[model samples]
Target: MVQVSESLFYKDVLLVFFEKEGYVYSNSSPTLLENIAKNLNNLSAPASAPKNFIVVHKKIIATSAFAVGGLVLTPIIVVGLIQAIGFGVGGIAAGSFAAWLMSLNGGATAAGSLVAILQSIGAAGLTAGATIGTGAAGATFMGTAGAKLFEEKSDSIMADLTERMDSNPKGQAQLDEFVKVYEEGNEDKNSEKGSTRVVFEIRDKLLTNNEAFKNFLETFVLAYNASKKLVNKKQQFKFFVDKTDKMDIAGKKLENLNVHLVKNYGAECVDKQAQSCTIMLNCSNL
Candidate 1:
């Protein structure tokens, strides 16, 4: 009767731990429980099982790889965003704009040149101080000129467009038409008609033929895309870390239970060379 009571107590302890860890045990599909038992058994043997046991936790393996990849890629993406916005005013869209800028100045990103300053911002960041400000001021001048055609809310619209462009490429024409109407609707500070409408009356066109405006839009798009991608990657990394932490806690709980069993039931309950304890306390049905 005492032996049976002890067996039931151990089962109850295992079940409680598993339940606390949000694991549901079922005899119909005992794979999860079997895996836990195998891992617990391996934990009892420190010499032969430790290395093999680490490999068995696939989450650890995936998390390690993901962490390394994020570490490597995050800086690159951040730099890309800074370059696109801080220096050029476009994120991913800045690629073409950068090429265009280079082309305009005989394709030379030589020292002290506009392209050189922009490149510096990409490599380091806005923290490059006065040098970065020079590039940003030049980009801002271009952006300000573009801003004249549309209302103050154009910046917000551009941001919305970036997200839309990133999410759906097919909606580009619709987005362009929306921007055209939005710009045309703006009340011109200097004239009765809006800047866009005035331009349309003179040139029979609403879209600015200005290269600066084109480059500004490109830079903004590129920066937004890079920033969005970085955010998503960070969220993914956080999720993996959370899962790893939960697994670590569960493993510790199992180890504590093993210690408890050994203290009350003797060394025979958790044989270091055999997994008799794991089999006895499988808690599969629970």
Candidate 2:
């Protein structure tokens, strides 16, 4: 149930963000990866039945794992933040936990574009899930990811960018050129796969492209903080997130998300004394 708030439904919007900001390598694989793709896709798809009734999709998952409510690590998008954060806490990809519960009773749905958007973001994020309980199932994996993210953010490329945007503030020209490259790349119709390839170029220009990998640190941090919030007040979990319509998701919401990031553990992290976390997917897939 590890879900990222910004990534849940906005995967499509993130396509714009990732394309405009990140790079997309045409690293397409063989049909052999279809099972892995399926497993990833299942992580985002609408719940089709109860956790135990899921039939244990063995294409990618070899054992009879009790896949409960899952979320998209971001294959992303949807608009809600807090609620989706709840999913991150749960150790699933980002989408919906309450929705998963609804599926158990109403049967799973076939939301095509929704799944596709999620798949896109999912590619950037690590997919994981945990059982339904106030135990380590979700916390184990999420906490680890979060701690790592926090521990390394200082060196991550995005951290540098955020630092520039936050501290230097005068380097708007470089950041702007970075945007221009993305724009030109998107329009060139001949760029690699005609997709966004500006991430590397921008990183190269900034300092080192090789080090400028996608900053999924925030993703793990979201899972960590949300997980802590969820586990500490198990009964009040529902109140933590405010459910919103899938269509309501937008790129603009990321602003608040950025703020949320700083408040949680980014450089702007307010609680200086808080310890790093280690979280994980609670489920056991054999």
Candidate 3:
């Protein structure tokens, strides 16, 4: 079991409360809680890697192929099976034609006509075979294309998300709100004796919009990473993100964050010495 001291635990709670309130420092007086919230939001940002076009292109191609195959193969199989079992009608027609011709002539010409009728039967068989082959080919093409398209689409979606991450005012505000909620929830849960149970409940609430929020965060991170090389090399980079339902509201969350851009890697300056950057984030509300 891990043992924690009462004073240490309260101290941690105080820090959390202060961070959540967006504390700031001024020349005369500092509202510690207000500064904490602002600082936390300023520091806590999601990943911003650039969208990879190669991946997006690949996904589109794959999806197109799958669509082609599904359109071509499924109907072919259903119709083909029906034809295979129903070909008896064609066989009967050919037999009737032979019998009718025999009644009209009993000489060598009748024999020649019979041979021609047999050739027609062979042709029908060849056509059926070709139909089945075509269906198989279509299905194969769709499967290959669909796989590629999936990969490509993932890349494209990520790229779009990152572009939006850089410029979403709504998203930043949501992050601020999330920090406030998280601090309140955490403090409430951790206030009592044997608080683990309460904390677990709070965690569940935090994960409500987590999946969508995670997707949003990834886009932001990807975009931020891509843009870092273009801006002043020494200018510090920061991100603010909210991991909650606010991101799922779609058109209300943010915009201009998910666009694509290019940068020259060789001309960029990276901070190798900057290691202690802290990210103060609010617990997710799912």
Best by lDDT: 1
TM-score of each: 0.17, 0.18, 0.19
User: Against the correct fold, how does model 1 do in TM-score?
Assistant: 0.17
lDDT string for model 2 (173-263, tens) is: 3443322222123343432354321121212222223222233223233333333332222111000112223212212232333344454
Query: In candidate 1, what are the lDDT values of residues 73-117, reduced to their tens digit?
Result: 233333443354334434223334445444333344557554565
Supply the global lDDT for candidate 2.
0.28
Q: Note the residue pairs that clash in candidate 1.
A: 89-219, 89-220, 90-219, 90-220, 91-219, 91-222, 91-223, 92-222, 92-223, 93-222
lDDT: which is higher, 1 or 3?
1
Say which candidate scores most in TM-score: 3
Off by over 4 Å in 3: 1-137, 173-286
Pairwise lDDT winner, candidates 2 and 3: 3
Misplaced by over 4 Å in model 2 are 1-22, 30-37, 44-47, 51-256, 259-286
> Candidates 2 and 3: which is better by TM-score?
3
lDDT of 3: 0.30
Cα lDDT tens digits, model 3, 1-286, are 1222222222222233322332311221234334332322322333121123224334433433244325445434423322332223254233233333222222123222432333333336545434435655645543464344323333333333233333444433344333321212224342343322111011122234454334333433332332232111211222223333434342222222112111211212222111222122211111
